[model samples]
Target chain A: MNTKIENKLTPVRIIAFIFVALWLVIAMFPFIWTLWGSFKVQADFFSKADWSNAIFGFHTEKQTGGFFTMDGYYGSWIEEEFWRAVINTSIVVFFTVLISLTFGTLGGYALARSTYRYAFWILMAGLIFRAMPHMTLISGYLQPFFAWNVWGILPTTIIVLVAINQPFTLWMLHSFFLNIPKDLDESAMCDGCNRFQAFRYVIIPIMWPGVITTGLFSFLLAYNDFTVTSMLLSDENETMIPAIASFLGTVQEEGKVMYAVAAVVSATAPLFFFVLFFQRQIVSGLTAGAVKG
Target chain B: MKHSTFLLFSLPSLSVMFLFIAIPIVSVFIQSLHIEHKQVIIVTENCDPFGCETTTAVDTEASAKLKEKAPLGKFNGFKTYSNRMHFAFDEVGEAWKSSDSFTVFTKKLYNYPLYRALSFTLTYTFVVTPFVLFLGFLVAVGVNNLPKMFKGPTIFASLLPMIVTPLVGSLILFWMVDGDGVIGATLQKIFNDNSLSLKASPVLTWIMLMVYGIWHLMPFSFIVFYAGLQTVPQETIEAATIDGASKFQRIRHVVIPHLMPLAIFITLILLMDNFRVFEPIIGFRAEAHATSISWLIWNHLRESAYPLYNAAGATSMVTIFGVAILLLPVLIRTWRDFKEKNKG
Candidate 1:
């Protein structure tokens, strides 16, 4: 009771609350501003005599007809055909996650169950893979991809992303499998199920939580990746990240900064809702790596 | 499980890893030792006119056929790695011999693409890693002490920065720091300087990036540490309190030691991530003032007409070596942990 009382009014507690409140503001403020600013003209947001012109929609007459405008969204999505990039992003992300998870689960399960010395070495290799910057491997891909005429295609990029994500996906899922009791699978095998049968019929249902958590990470990687996509993809196959990046390069000269801003907001909106919906899974997935390590 | 089953299960991942990760690394190293084929030019002189003249021309047709025959380019045997854009060995030596002072020599060193990137990458990695850890730890403690009702929303808010796409997040911050944007204008107004721009200068850009690094990564550290905090023994805390230790003393002695492993885990991840820092630089369009190794590779690859694959390959090798060196401590720790676990 005395400790509980002390916790209520201690200077440390008060200071912590104040600091966290400030941090919360700093963390959430930029996205909110960007979201609102995306609905306005460049002049209103970035060229007015005062910054409040952004909030009040002052001097935005040419870009918008009213207090709120969808011109940026219209310009980005329709005029510039950002929808193609969106479709490309969605397709790549879907395939990358599917392929990565398929391989990651099998590999992770094998690594977790096997006692072979080779498995240890393989896991070590995965660690090295994790540490390697993707750009290094991309350099190798450029030549072979060009030679094979597979460069700048979605399938090639998807496969490469899956390979790149495998090390991390394997590591995370491996740890997740380790937490599951080995006996669960062993008993299934005792019941005359083969290893594959045991994995399919017995262990899989229980593994969904871990799989879903790992899947969230894979999705994030496939979705949020800019470096891999930008380098591997071409103009026809631009993903949203690279497409928006191209906007940043071209929009300034063309006076369409608002399109880039709108696209940024559009790209971020999914992630915003993603966090809101999947916060628990994300937190578990995130902490799972550190805790296991 | 049968050995065959294990092998079959792991084969797909193993194959992909080999095809992409392992083999590409080997290929990148090999590719770094080569350069594009250049046509041999012939010089001819004509003395039929009032004055003699000379003409030099590249034999393009022969060069094109040669390129098709050997598309990997001619092997230069590490010459590409030492060229001006890479290690710049010759230039560095000249600068060292000719420069009057250490500062001048250092300036000349930074003029080389490799060292310029190396300096900034190292500084960003070292500086951002510690600050992320510190801020994350602070936020974790703060949120841990908060009431349950506030914790969920606070965490949700904090996670936004980390969860959003890196390029998009950096762009959001970029807009805010634009010269006429809200935060930038407000800053100027407060400082009484209309011309001051955070995006215009190098030092300020680095600071903003560092701030972004902290903000973006803090939630990760906070989440991990908060989880670590929950598992800290309540009995130890009670014991410390009953022994009349002050709050700071108790925290320093008990809480920190308890969270040390998580701290180290966060540090390892941060170091690796920060070393490959590319997206923010791109999103910020900061190539003028700050360029990372990854950015250098991007620049080389983006040359549409004459993509410098050789230069990129060399830079990739250097970046890989840098990552290896930075990861040495963590690798040692991992090995030690594995040995101890095996022994136990």
Candidate 2:
């Protein structure tokens, strides 16, 4: 690794470049595949498609340009339920992040500044809670929700997402709180500001990146999840991932896989939106929480 | 006064944790001891003998059904375990069905289809998680010293995958991977017919999964790692340089300790997530072959035809046990640090 950099123009340097270049090529395959698969019609897709079914049978019966047609592929996201999933994910992401930021700030400050006896247990518990699979809550636990009511939507999904995201929120925020130099807290105290005032005015601004990244994670987790949502949400109207799979599953066996493939491609938009927006802050925030105090 | 206020701040989070996180864990243990709403171990003391003699016919029928299959009555501790073991051992030659679609063990959990679903799922997660982390870390380290003008956007691009909601991301990958999808048609136009079937290939499906997984998770590790990199004091690096420390030396001596906590955090996060991971597996199910342990468990809950719902429950607990052991150290360390930090 170091051989390439030592001379700057050595064979090793060229090899290193080639290796990285190759890595990029390998990494680009799936995205390329998704794009390629979007154009092929159903029959061509079914006959020739092997494993990566995203493009194989992507054609339709209409002979607009022979084997090509976007309608056969990209038409599903226009469906009402797809939009409902968007709204459903948005609702959970917005509120769950909101809850994490609000509570995480307070809890983090408390952990950083206060003498609490059970703080260790709380932290450990939070770690375990975060570590535990969200699916367990839906499948193994929460019998009442499955058995008793079997109806309704908002509170159930919202509450569960909120709980699932809390552990990561608490763990990450606590680190952010620890990073603030104690002198800052002392200086605020000396300036006649109480702890809350110090936290609200002095600390919160500095910790904005932490709050943002944690909130981003919470939002992403809620939006991307499938297992708990599959069990907790029986309603097709509220389904988030019911449509994204392509070229495989029993759906493939039933001949709908091609259509499903088209539908799933549209799901990539929101995540792109997040990456496009939070690029810098996410990096700074996560590295800060991970690498530093 | 200062410490107490902090406690006040922590209260809502703590309470919420107890209510949602803590309580659910307790319920898992409770459910494990005795199956819910059945007669695995009939609680005669609760109602029948106590004089609150109200019982429904449906409840009676259910209890009767439970009792008939339960060769191990209330006095029989874990008799079902032996029975299952016996069944598995006896059927070694013919473990699966006549159609040979799936095994008795696999079918017992959710129907054969769920495990069928899981085969693809496990295939994807096993392939996706490690490679994403490995490649992500390399990218983070490589771009660590670049100028912000180049570095910021470079790292930002990696974040592209993580930022997208999984639902949306999977859809995009789904379209992008198939040969007839947008990119494939263009490739075919440029290179002709030989290039189009990439999405149909199972190997290509995993490649797509790895790409999507990397795209989604790279941002997370990059951000986390970049943050950690920022904290590595210039003084330490300067000191290493003055002593003629090689880049490897700096990375090994100065950089690694500097990044240990972050690395551990991300790795642990991945481990916990890997076990319970069901989304990408389920999401990519159509084309990309995959399923995780959690998905199989879920299949049992959602799919009624699953032969052994109880066995799936038991199998899922196997995954939980793995998580509990792997994360015990992190949980312990966090507890100690949290206590120290909370001391006013």
Candidate 3:
């Protein structure tokens, strides 16, 4: 490119350039702070932990420690409980996402294809369920777990998560099926293809975006979920957030507080990567429209 | 033929959904009602009979019973309703009523703090939704119309805040806004007196919360609206310009309407998610005057010294109904007014 031509960018372009650049820094500031703070030693944290004093004035004293060390990471490593939380969160996220997606896809396809009366009502039921506050289910439904034995306890937590997530995944994919005009199916039938074949070949390919987006969202729905897990799950298996939370108890148990951040960081690792890897689609895909259900 | 095909397409999905979600919900409802004698609600023993051996084996069969029941009532319709009828926690009457110094509103109000909670969420939803939408739109439109090279980076740049977890987001806000702290001290440079805590004043707390919410949420909205803008038909905008439509008018009439469906989607998500909030309250409640239905439940559960479990359930049931009412307007619009909008 010629130098003069490159320099001849429009005023609008120049203006947007600055705005978005400034925005990216402001946007990344939190994550950057989290990353940096995760590395800092305890005395440094005591200084930075202060909201009023330390932020702009954040500094390291030379005598005490290395500027960039793994005190937080190593400190958190000592807690056996923190590792168990890792297991707990993974269990919930794995089962919750897998189950909801399986049933939700089926449910979405059914609601989309139903020509009968009350089909909309069925879909509406899902929407109302989706709109319900998580606390409602957690509060009313948690009692039943006490009714059962040991096996019922784990499966019960998974059920709460699946119930909470089903409506979201179903409604999301249902819209995708709807936006696909009905003519494709009609034409496929005229071509002598059966209902299953049309959906398998023609409809499914085009709706892949919706499926992927919905699947990713469902994965996120389960992975990012904390409140339901917090309420539903009992001890020893408290999902990641609560595990980290147990560390922050009024007592400075858990050997050190930094591991709480480490545990939080590890728990969110899959979620954070999912967001970053799927950045374009996630950002573009999650609309106010997502609240439709 | 079409019907059969549709049935084939639909049945499998419907069955799984029915099996998992629908059945569980119905089961919960049934469990909530306590008329059935078979439905055992084991009230834990005050004194372990295992420890207090030979303690009052009153009846002949009482030893075989599961820890001895207390006339555990027989199941009947509306039994759950009747059991909790006096515990509705509402003040419904023709006149305002007083319970000691606190004046409970009569004429059927939802739980008092719940009203405050709902209102608090509503105020957040209303302010944050539009503010984020408009800010996102401005950035998106401005960035999209950028030199082709800058658009991609700009879009990626704005998405960082939306991707971080709520815990981290709160921590950042915590670091910046503490009293006589970093952010406060920074403000003190301009406003004087670093001793002022953001938590000290309701106004400051609200302002900071608004800032935190918008900062975190704007990126998500910007990403979606930007895509919606791209799909916006260019010729219509060009024609509007040719007809001498000013920039403001063009956006108000042309761009905004194109983005309405997306806006509604964002609104619905915000309406649902913000109302059911969890993190912000847990983080800010120490100093801030903020508390929602979510945080209230957490506080109760956290202080589980009393195991306020039943009360939490009752509170949750009421909160769900409150949310349903809040969402009812959209429900009415989607069901009844949707076709009207299409025709118009």
Candidate 4:
């Protein structure tokens, strides 16, 4: 891909390399540092005497008779029951992704195929709905949910998350469906299949690539969400993010800041692997709107 | 597709959006017009040895019954919208009358909860959007110049800041900038000021939050711009070079105009996201110095004694209005584009 004008070691090339290298350090260093420090005692991680102690683990060694310790992990996972939150997160994320995709695929397909004005209006309305903050909607749901006796449960949260997720899900999947040929579905209908039958027999199989890409985003939204889950779910049903936040409150006062550190690192691990595996899908999904628009 | 077919296909998704999103906004408006039920007070008269005395006390059971009967509380019209915690019309009027200058008056106005949150939210939205665009463009250019072998790893690392949960990302930064943490400690040592702490200063806290915002948002913009760069057309670049144009001139005249549409898309998303900047404030514990509209609603709902549904509803309605105003320009632009496309 390189041409003669772009290949030379010019001043601009050097600057670009240096700038990217600096940004990489800024982006990745915090996670690496936190991951490393999670194993150390609070005294060492927040070393009063020397910053070098954090890297060397002097205080950790003195406290636990080793260079590394699992005290933070133990305290958060076992003593504090962070595993309950982990299980709760798994349930919420799984159901939210499943339901959002189910609803989004149907709606996105119809919007993509229809040439009607109302279809355009629906898409526009979805765009506006997408921009509403989660907290505002939660404020509305509180009184109603409380009155209905459906508040503070996993099912209610999953449904709300699925609804919040619908707008973006529809938009992304709509663009993806638009990229598919209309002839594929039309031909199936021509063969005496009904609309649903065509979508089931013809469109469903080929739609997996788009569905998978859209599902990755749906999964991320459900997993990374803090606002809806935090406010809607009861304390017993708290997910990982809110669990970590609550850790900050009680752990800090009890001089167990390392528990919060370990929890943060634990929460970040899945996302790290998420980017590693689904990097391509995430990139494509992010650019889908831009490219189409 | 026929109208019947479309309706059958889209009903489930549309129904949920209508029920949860559309209805809730209307509900938020309705709730904002009402305030919570006041406690039921009863007076008891007793004759003591010395004198007759009367005492007033709140009847908890009656209050509970009242709340249960009407969960929406008493209708108070638009009073909640103008209260001190919201638009604060009375407070603003007082400040306007007392102060001789605009800056002085604004300083007085900033003391109100709504104004303080609004100023920070607007400042953050305006400041962070542009910086994310500019820096994201630079990073995209830089990454584009890298060797093919290094691109994937560089992109992966860049995605980390953006991909992680916002609260977790901010907390990681918050810990580092704590008084005893590495960055914070090193700064103190370098400045020879042991008392220096990032969390203690309002200005530094705002800057820190903005830096966190940029860090968390820039990667999305970078990825979009990088994709746009891939389609910049090699023929055009070669033509610009052959025509004796410098790299900067070619980029200014050709490449930038190519990416303009993507820039608009990123800016719209960034503004919407930044306007709801709630998690970072909570993560960084920066509420003492700064707040946002979303955070104001959250604070009201998370009140110590009981959830102030009315107060939260009022703030939420204001926030919805803010979002509507912010999206109006883009909505108008999109409508115009749709019309022109149809005509052509």
User: Alpha carbon lDDT of residue B341, candidate 2?
Assistant: 71
Model 4 shows how many backbone clashes? 0
Please write out the lDDT profile of model 3 over residues B1-344, one tens digit for every residue.
35565455556555555654455445545444433234333344445755743333234354336334623223354433323332333343322355332344521333444455555666776787788877877788777766567666665656656655665466556654654334555576566665677777866776777777888788877877777887788899999999999877888999899888888777776677667766765555442366667666665555666434434544565566667887898889778764575467
Docking class of 3: acceptable
- Candidate 4 lDDT, tens digit per residue, B117-179? 999999999999999999999999988886676689888998899989999999999999999
lDDT of each: 0.89, 0.60, 0.62, 0.93
Residue A139 Cα positional deviation in candidate 2, in Å, after optimal superposition: 2.2
Tens-digit per-residue lDDT, A6-98, candidate 2: 435545445544544454444445545554555655555543333344333433434345455665344455633456666776776677778
Error of 1 at B235 (Å): 0.5
Give the total clashing residue pairs for model 1. 0
In model 4, residue pairs whose N, Cα or C atoms come closer than 3 Å (at least 3 residues apart or on different chains), thus clashing, are none
Return model 1's CA RMSD, one decimal.
Answer: 1.9
**lDDT of candidate 4 over A84-110, digit per residue (tens):** 999999999999999999999999999
Model 2, stretches more than 4 Å misplaced?
A: A1-13, A32-62, A65-74, A78-80, A147-152, A181-209, A243-259, B1-7, B36-134, B144-150, B163-261, B284-291, B305-313, B332-344
What proportion of true contacts does candidate 4 retain? 0.81
Q: Flag regions of model 4 displaced more than 4 Å.
A: A1-8
Using lDDT as the measure, which candidate wins?
Answer: 4
Candidate 3 docks with a DockQ of: 0.39
